[model samples]
Target: MSGHRTRKWVRVAGTAQICALLIGMAAGGCARLPYTTQVIHEDRRVVVTLQRETRPVPYSHPVQLRTDELAAALAGFSFREKQRLPLRWFAEEVPPKQIFRSDELQAVVPYLVEGLQKAAPDERVYFQVLAPGMNPAYEKDTTAGWIALREPYLHLTLEHFHAQFPVRKSEQWDLRYPALPPEPKTYLLYFEPGRFWETDPVTGQSAVQLREFLKIAIPASSR
Candidate 1:
């Protein structure tokens, strides 16, 4: 999916409950897919790999990531780019209905926060919650309440952010999913390190000061 198309879906996902239905439909089908998780930590970046296993789906279940383990996996990296790497891996290996339903993956959020706190104690961290389909903006408390009630796949992202960032104000954007190009993209979550004014004194108009820091791009293949 092109970044443009993905954003459009996200806009739609924000309003409609179709994704839940799609997930349900996909889950009802047979043929389980194999997936792998890889976490790479470097000086300024942490790359998490959730890809398909080349081998067949094993009879053994994948282990769930503990909060501390998830945190440790993401430790010492900054998501400065603010892009949700496309979930093409899910599309490639798993059915759409099964896409966001992996408890093993969903379980990583809180622990990832724990690891992030240790990795960058003084720095703020953020994770993207809105998928290809999600409402552009939602009231913080209302969104939180809805997530608690709905307990959708997106709750993984939202719950983690609520635990870590705590701050209510934020800006969201659609960015190309990293790695997968030309077809699929994903949502990016961002953390604000500090507070800034959304209004411009010079123009007496409201604008997002932090938006300048966001990265928006499409892979050459997708373009």
Candidate 2:
């Protein structure tokens, strides 16, 4: 089972690598290629943004979703260390760039379907790939493309939390960093939680447990 998951991850990573090549060629303005590729994980609700290091610009659309609907969906996929949920996701692009070859694209389909079937089989999963906004250099100018592009990010809405609380006067001293030139300092936090699997009501799915992943949504405070 572990081998299967590893293979799936490798395939996804390979797709990303291929897309990177397509982006390079398209941005180069080779009429022969005529297009660039972008990846969108609809279920993850994120569009991978690509850019050159020096010219940092938003070359893609923001990942978005209905917050209300997202919350309800998340509630159904309860986090447990022992559970393994299959997820369905995809890649797409605007201006029609062929980032993936037939074989690569074919490789992705099953991986996604299987993942989704295991994670949220009954739930709807969507995907799209898009080219980002036109770069100034590549605006009307056809020449001067082909540059080193950064690695596209895999945007996943794994999980996040928000905690609200008032700090105590005594604790305020510890929060300040007088030794660090009055600049604010942040400390790392860690959490250990027990996990187990329960049947999901919305999708009627099950997941395998590997490691316990935890996030401290709301931190406890004495103040």
Candidate 3:
């Protein structure tokens, strides 16, 4: 089953590659396909592989970086450039249904925060972004429609927690967690955004998209 699942992705990836080529030709600009290169949680880093023009490009370019650095890099890229990275985090208008419905993944927000605190102790963690909304503010709470959370070490199902939590039309928040030493560790969580719907161009995608989620920033201190 694992091998079949892997192969299925490979085939889907091939199809996406062809689609990229078609779209790139139409746009007359570099077309890129998203792909995963490597994910090292112990190092708190994930690298994505990309390809363009039948040439190998950094799809989801791999980098040795903390969560914040990852988030910043992802947000800074253009939409076209973003296609190169196979990150699920994107600012789409449609809600991520596929992830939420999966039994393999679950959301437990407060629990995640508590666990991180227990493990890291003195570290101050802050959330840069989470569901219902997305913004740059690191301290102000949401009005009523959105929710966001930032912190030191990003726990698994961080998105699931926010999504399942109550919120109005849209929400956004910035949460900070304590800091930890550079010593290596591995954090793992299964993220399932169930039945992905079309992205609303205006909103892009869910407040927490695949690319954005993987870019979990572990800050040194809270602002």
Candidate 4:
């Protein structure tokens, strides 16, 4: 969760440590990281472009991203209100609201994964997730962001997320701006490499990973 998207990225510091989450599962699961030797790959298009590079971003062998899984995960991930309610409370829990939808995820995740592989040591993979405005006359609501692999930790930063003002101009128009889309709280969750890496029982070596975690819950999938 971050403040209204700005030019600044919200950095999650002190996160280079190995993540032990799901270590047992990985040890038995055998899911490997999508890494590549070509070290440089690019996908450029009218709306976006992504490059995945390695060097400054030190990575080992075998780069392959399960773009489908990644997209599904991104499509499912959401932001929810943080307030705690008592068990006796009569009100229902708030639903989780997704930041991106299925259609957008299908179009965006592949490029993002590819770009991460082609990133320059100092750069990040970037893109904007968009939603049409409620009013036809306005610009689309957008969530602008980037993803970077800072060694042990991968960072996803949403720098600018803002909804456009719907304009209705007239002498007798309502005297105020329309309400914009709801924004998310700044939340940065860290899962160590262990969360992504799994040990191969047969090879006695750990297979690296580019991973995603998901929990099943219905979400309001929109901005």
Model 1: per-residue Cα lDDT over 106-184, one tens digit each: 4435533443333221122223332221332422211110010010011112222211212233334322211121221
User: TM-score of every model?
Assistant: 0.18, 0.16, 0.16, 0.42
lDDT on C-alpha atoms for all candidate structures: 0.30, 0.27, 0.28, 0.45
lDDT of 2 by residue, 4-45 (tens): 897687667666766876899899875531232322232221
Off by more than 4 A, model 3 = 1-54, 58-62, 66-94, 98-217
lDDT of 4 at 211: 39
- Candidate 3 per-residue C-alpha lDDT over 1-223 given as tens digits, one digit per residue, 9 for 90 to 100: 6988976776676667668767989989655632222221111111111111234311111122333333332232211111222343452332433222221112222322332233222222222122333332322222111112222122221212222222232221111112111222221222333222123243233323434434343334631
Model with the higher lDDT, candidate 2 or 4: 4
lDDT tens digits, residue span 62-94, model 4: 233457645644553444333444731422354
For lDDT, the strongest prediction is: 4
lDDT of 1: 0.30
Ranking of all predicted structures according to TM-score, beginning with the best and ending with the worst: 4, 1, 2, 3
- C-alpha RMSD (angstroms) for model 2: 25.5
The ten-residue window of minimal lDDT in model 1 covers 144-153
User: Candidate 2, 104: how far from true, in Å?
Assistant: 40
